[model samples]
Target chain A: MNISIKRKDQGDHRFLVAVSGEIDVFTAPELQKGLLPLTEIRGGTLILDLNETRYMDSTALGVIVAALKSASRHQCSFSVTGMTPRIQRLFEITGLMELLKRVQTSRGVAND
Target chain B: METQEDESQLSEYRTLLAHYISQKDQKLPTEESEHLRRQLHACGILPEDLLGLHIEALKGAGIFSESAMMRSLNFLMKMMSGYSKAYREHQELKDWQKQLDTELDIASALQKTLLDGKVPACSFADIGAISEPAKRMSGDYYRIVNDGKRLVVTIADIVGKGIPAAMCMSMIKYAMDSLPENSQGAPSYILSLLNRVVERNVDTNMFITMFYGVYDPETGIFSNSSAGHEPGFYYSAREDRFMDLEARGLSLGLAREAEYKEYARRIYSGDMIFLLTDGVTEIRKDHDFIEREQIVALIRRWMHLPAAEIVKQVMRALKKMQDFSLQDDFTFIAIKF
Candidate 1:
């Protein structure tokens, strides 16, 4: 589990949480702990960066959904960027891709 | 008389062998053939019969007479040489086969030891972890340990497949064993320590993606660190949503003093936690890679079930999609908080 939580100093208060690796039953909790705290933070756009991610199972997909809900309660926006082809297909198949803004990289995001 | 009969059989067997040799363009020695002819002429049978007997023993030698043949030293020498060669070859083959089998046994045992089963602590109620190696030895390894305060569980995958990967897995196990027990604070620190241990020993070409965590039973809080392994999942029944817990960390052994961040979260009583290796993600269906939804559907379908049932259901889905034998090792560990 690799997670970096960055709060913007003076911008849109964007929270970029870059994650890579397989997210499944054993590892889901790690991401949950890392991201759940971000959800509690007052207001910031939560960006999940997953470019280096190689594989994701249902347990992992569930964590992202849970993180989204956690952030939503705080009125903080949540989205996934750097969707690998495998993960992108997963997001699309799970119907979450439509719900989140999928970007190739954090820099690739056209919207601030 | 018996010596005469033996000589006749010997000559006959020799003739057959000579014939076979001739067919294959090998010429018979004149003295040898002449001796065989003499043995047959002494008896009523043709020289061919004598030669055939010789071939049966496959040890044709000089002819034996009535008196001297009884003590036929020449015949004994021929028989000894022929029998010795054949027996030696057979013994050699058996020995070689035994040696090969021993090597395979050691490899198999190593594999089994690497994937040792966890007696799933009775406290968890339902917990299961399994790994299916595609070959003789699997590159996948998983462990569940009670950290007194929490259950520290992990599953790791070495990048390359087969024995090499399996060896790397062994290194991971040993490194994990060496880590300090139940240390509080960040799970990432433990992983960082393990990463240094793994890096110091493993080759630069090999890297491992691992999910290592300590889960507190009382707090339902789980802290974990990933090193280029896989994503994990958290299922929330109240919200009817499955969240993807994504953690980004540098792969272990990639660099010296590589820094890995730790992630922590609390799980409710109804929530479930799932972790797996890339083998699950790389599962194939109809000559195509299985998309994440098919996997989620498996979890969604089994959400109401127990932890073991959920793990089994997902495993079945992967098995069905595989159609053929899975090319990579498949490992899944599930724990319901």
Candidate 2:
């Protein structure tokens, strides 16, 4: 029902978003505001931290998926990390984990 | 109660009920009993509606002893109060999962009969399906019926839960069974007929979402229809990607004259149709839940396996995601052509 989102710039247009609290249907809209703009950071990296996120629903997941898709279209680097086991299960069930893994693998290859 | 026909039927029922009430060793003849039931239904009467009044008449006549009637009344009152309390708790707490009584138990049994339906063997299409309830009673219902020439699969979720929801499901099952299944572009027709039934008889607060599809082997075309159900996926083997199987309509019972449109695709080799209830995608653990994309991935990963095996693996993955504890009824069908 409650969510807190803090955005920090890592310079060079790189941003790290730390999200915490419960993100069910009621609060997914708020998450959308904090995450979508950063997704279009063109030539920069967007990292979302869900370590403090205690809960999330399908609506919130949709927001994240939208951000993921938007980032891909913009050709910006996007990454997600710090998922609790519970949150991890959510991603795993949604096939987002596989998508994220593919991105990470591609990013790793590009970096090398 | 006012019509001459009703009066005549009432007199007959009065004679039958009175005799039955007085004599413990007598049985109503089957034809007569069926006629009485049909007449009662036609008169918008339930048997219980007549029983109390009949009992009062018999008591006044001193034909029935007071003790047995008092005991029956007391028992009925007790069950009524129990049901009232259970319903109250259910509403206040947002917990619609409680199985109210023997009626709900019977409804749950009927739901299992739907699950036990066999997928008709099709040389061109292989089908796999299963439905699991989160509790003793399930709001989700799926049935796979072979119409001799084509296979028809129906997946539905009642908006409300418990006995009433299950009863609606039974009505749907029978109604689907009686439909002319072999007609081309009949998926929409089937949903419209079902929608009329739900709108007329079901409670105002209750509605149902259904996805129905008929697969034709000769043309390899699977035409589908939806009644406010989530759109499923159609995997195109040639394209090597999944596409949404799109069709639109209001949920059944929302509007008496609701219309569902048909969507069709030629299911080529390696193509499959995937249909499911929201329970599979909305599964929430402590901090997270699964979604449609995750399910699509599960299917894509298992595409090479047998259709039945693909459905089973998806079920297993969903169970694991929810930590082997379901929060809702899970039912899905995978059809490969």
Candidate 3:
């Protein structure tokens, strides 16, 4: 249940978040707190690094999906990196990998 | 034993009680009662200390003078005795529970073997399935109905255990049995009917994640739907790739007004439809769990075998991967068309 989240502002509204530790129901709220606001980075990229994250449940997946949706609405680009095989497979199983793959990879698009 | 501070507080309480009795005709303010509660707490009187006070009053011995008899022994002794009795009853209940669990396990096995009959035969597709419980009972349930031209397979990952979960599965099976035969075509329609049964009967905490797929051998189309279950896989032997069986819906019994969407895929010759529960993919490796891709890789590795043989081979490898000790119920069904 020990999750560590660190956020760095890359200037001009761009952000990089590095998350490590277990992400279950207990720690998902903490992750949501760290990821949601940065999704509003207009015309910027929000890169989420989950390489050191050990475990995650469906709840954490939901949080990430919500963050992706928020980013899309704000015209911010979103992408995930540093997923271990175990974590990557979780995304695949829940059908979120398909969604993640479709997430707008370009730098900016105007929100309608 | 009473602390020195508690002994002093007791004298103070006694003096106050004597004063109250002497002025019995006068009404004390409500604040005085609150003050007494605080004073008792300040004197380290535990919640169970009242038992000692009550015992003292019943004896009318006024043995506070002896002081030695006025400590927490009364509370501890009574609590210990009560706890001892409760522990004995708990052990007895566990024994009865063990007995009930065994009987239920037998009943469930018999239900699978004797009652529902065998998995119906499909002329064009070879079907293979295996459901193994981590405990004496399995909460995971699967039902396959094949009527030559059409095959409807439903797999559910129930969120409960033992008698309640088994009984729920039985009820669901009965409901499915009673539905009209034509209802088999629309996976969404069948799921809605099952959803009503689950919403009304199953406990609020117990929800079910299920995938219902109806395959037509004549048309080679497999129409499917999901109820918050894991996305299944469709393997194309010619393409050498797996397409995500992505259908989204709320978990059964989550809400009475839930809606499920349907998806259709063309099943070509040598293509396989794979549906499974979390138990299989969540199988552990030391501290971490195996992912769904590993299962996909396993299927691809043994792609040349018949559907049934591939199932057995994948299970054998998975069993060894986890060293024969499963942490949850492992249930999966594969059909090669």
Show the colliding residue pairs in model 3.
none
Report DockQ per prediction, comma-separated: 0.02, 0.02, 0.07
Runs of candidate 3 with Cα error greater than 4 angstroms are A1-112, B1-98, B114-117, B182-185
Give candidate 1 misplaced runs (Cα > 4 Å).
A1-112, B1-98, B122-125
lDDT by residue (A7-102, candidate 2, tens digit) is 999899899999999876568778888888888877668999988987765446657766776676566678888987766755654345655665
lDDT of 2 by residue, B151-182 (tens): 87888886544555567777777776676546
Give native contacts recovered, as a fraction, per prediction: 0.00, 0.00, 0.04
For residues B5-52, write the lDDT of model 1, one tens digit per residue.
Answer: 686565555554445343433334547655554555545554345345
Which ranges of candidate 2 are over 4 A from the true structure?
Answer: A1-112, B1-107, B180-185
Q: Against the unseen true structure, what C-alpha lDDT does each candidate score?
A: 0.66, 0.71, 0.71
Candidate that beats the other on TM-score, 2 or 3, i.e. the better one: 3
The candidate, 1 or 2, that scores higher on lDDT is: 2
**Pairs clashing in candidate 2?**
A94-B294, A95-B294
